[model samples]
Target: MMADHENAGYRRLFDGDGLTFGTGFPLTDNRTSRPPVERELELAAHAESVGFDALWARDVPLYWPRFGDAGQTFDTWPWLSQVAARTDEVALGTASVVLPLRHPLHVAKSAATVDRLSDGRLVLGIATGDRDPEFDAFGVDREERGARFRESVDLLRTVWREDFPQVEGRWGDLDGELDLVPEPTTESLPLLPTGHARQELEWIAEHGDGWLFYHLPESTLESYLDDWREAAGEKPYAMAVRSDLADDPEAGPEHVHQGFRAGTAWFREYFRRLEELGVDHVLVSPAGESPEADLQRFAADVIDRL
Candidate 1:
């Protein structure tokens, strides 16, 4: 069972003794175009029924065709709000919201509202954002993303925790006048800085409740975990893995984009190794013709075994 956290999402994910599993959006197809969103709720609920721990959505502000992925093709707040309404037990989150692309006030309000809607089941993953074309389109200075991301994090925490407080930043100034309403169910939302967000690992360790990263090799991950333990000491670490399961359960591993294409038996051992290395959570993106079945099989094969 999961332990207690001020935020239900955090507790469900990090307040545990071993590694856990979650899945990303567009769970059905691995395409760059629009996804089968109509089926997402059904699939999401099914995932929860089958014992998936969390469900994540990506924040792709625009569908920059030059870049190959369109993400979930829905706004994160509304999409996650509905996901929250559909599934009661699974935690809901953004794979990582592009902090620099959005204003902090808007991001804070939307996140808090989702947390309330989900009964405190929102764990926000934030990032500085890539894609120069997107930055140009949004009229955001691409170079300032790192700095803006820092400001956004600080501002989000401040506004969520305080009422009508004085705050100033490059985004704008919030004098002690009005307040951002419907504060989060918790004092503050759980923020997981994704992909470094262009900050020092130490700073990420110091400020973020956890860290969200892409899939890395075991050797590299071990080195990273060693550094993390030295700097942050037990702060939960999460990563995303793109996977494909083979028909034969005995097949060995093959290299894929962010993760490996392996048989269930080998996959289970891989996850076990991740747990032994102190990974707290993993966001798995299923890549197969039958994603829903893959979801169930993976839960049975790997998650239950863990």
Candidate 2:
């Protein structure tokens, strides 16, 4: 059985860490060409073997060609459930699920199922969603997504905590009330908001367990951290970086999205700087490289170094 979020075990898993490390899936180039799902899982297990702390999956319901990045080729719910079942210790997380596109009932059920299967190792990241095609396909409005996201989150929480909780929101209303049976292993699942999503810092700090950010420079990171701290009070912060490590030790820093293309030595220094800046966790994406080998190399060369 899973423990509650307030449980000591849960705290140790998420916050009481020696700096957690994890990999984001997609296993493909921005062009959507790369290894298969089996290869990706193999690499994910290898990441666990090499002492990584977590494995994160992304939801890409619709691949917008212009968006450049088609996150993890598979659907998210099943993928996360499978990954959770396969891995023993590594925490499983969704880089984010587009809450506005799916019903809160579905979100609560799916997340609870994963958390139960993973023994409370699930970290749920929620987002308002940006892809217009996905919204259109689901017959939802893109402009109203932010409102929907807040409503869905509120409803999901109610379903988890209260028995037969009623919900009313812009999307719709649940009058009879519904409870998520076989509640999450943890009393409450950790929810990290991806980007601002039209929410205020105060709301994020008061409600979110953590914050997830994209690529930002070191200078920007400092200010962002300050803001996060100001709002978070005591909650943790996480950031993702895209890296392509090379064999050359002296490779100069090449600009990537939120990270850089550098050798292990530079990578070590960069992570150390992030740690110094009070980042609680850092997840990396193997930008256009062999997912398994590159992630393993990074774990051994960079993660282990810290």
Write model 2 residue lDDT over 1-306, tens digit each, in one string.
433454322354455655677777765443364437676677677778887787888877877888876787678888987787677878888888989888878888888888887777888778888877888899997888777878777887777877776667765666764456779875678888888977888888877878888878999989999999887775778888877887786677899767788888888888898888888888886535566677777877888888
Q: For each candidate, what is the lDDT?
A: 0.88, 0.76
Worst 10 residues of 2 by lDDT: 1-10
RMSD from true fold, candidate 2: 2.6
Query: Which 10 residues in a row give candidate 1 its minimum summed lDDT?
Result: 1-10
1-306 in candidate 1: lDDT tens per residue? 332224988889988898888998887764476677668888999899898899999999888777888888888999999898889979997888999999899999999999999999999999989878889988999889989999999999899888998988888898899799898888889999998889999999988888899999999999998998888887899999877898888899899899888898998889889999999999986536887898889888878887
TM-score of each: 0.96, 0.91
Please give the TM-score that candidate 1 achieves against the real structure: 0.96
Candidate 2 regions with alpha-carbon error over 4 angstroms: 1-13, 28-35
